[model samples]
Target: MTESDIITAVNEVFCEEFEVPLKELTPESQIFDDLGLDSLDVVDLIVALQKKFGVQVRNDERVREVRTLQDLYDLLEVIKREQTSA
Candidate 1:
């Protein structure tokens, strides 16, 4: 899928998982402080991302590297590019 497609999917999941309005979840929003997502929530977010994007998030270390919504978008873009090539 394209980067926009992945971002849309990720945003949907984030809104649902965080129980926050879509308008509140922006690219600059931080997953922890801004979104109030704890470690477990982060795991769930990664799982949702992997499922939606058909990408493997692998481990906590990798997931922890993601802070802002843009980071998630970038990660998804990389995964989508790899999937397209393979």
Candidate 2:
């Protein structure tokens, strides 16, 4: 799917599951600082995303570098693209 579609899905999941307001979830919003999510929250987020997208996100170096909403959207875009192609 397209990046916009990925973003839309991410936003919907965050809003529904995390109780994060739609207006506050900007591209520049940091997951920890802006969203007030701790490490455990991040683990839960990853689990939810994996289940929702049916994609196994590797616990790799790149995943650890994700810091913002845009970062995650970009990462998911890559993951989804690879999944579809494979």
- Give me the candidate number with maximum lDDT: 2
Q: What C-alpha lDDT, on a 0 to 100 scale, does residue 50 get in candidate 2?
A: 88
Give stretches of model 1 more than 4 Å off: none
Candidate that scores best on TM-score: 2
Over 51-80, each residue of candidate 2 has an lDDT whose tens digit, in order, gives 878898756567898999999999998888
- TM-scores for all candidates: the values are 0.85, 0.92
TM-score of 2: 0.92
Distance (Å) between predicted and true CA of 72, model 2?
Answer: 0.3
Q: Which ten residues in a row have the lowest lDDT in candidate 1?
A: 55-64
Q: 1-81, model 1: which lDDT tens digit per residue?
A: 667787788889977766788987899999899988898777787787777777788653555688899988987787677
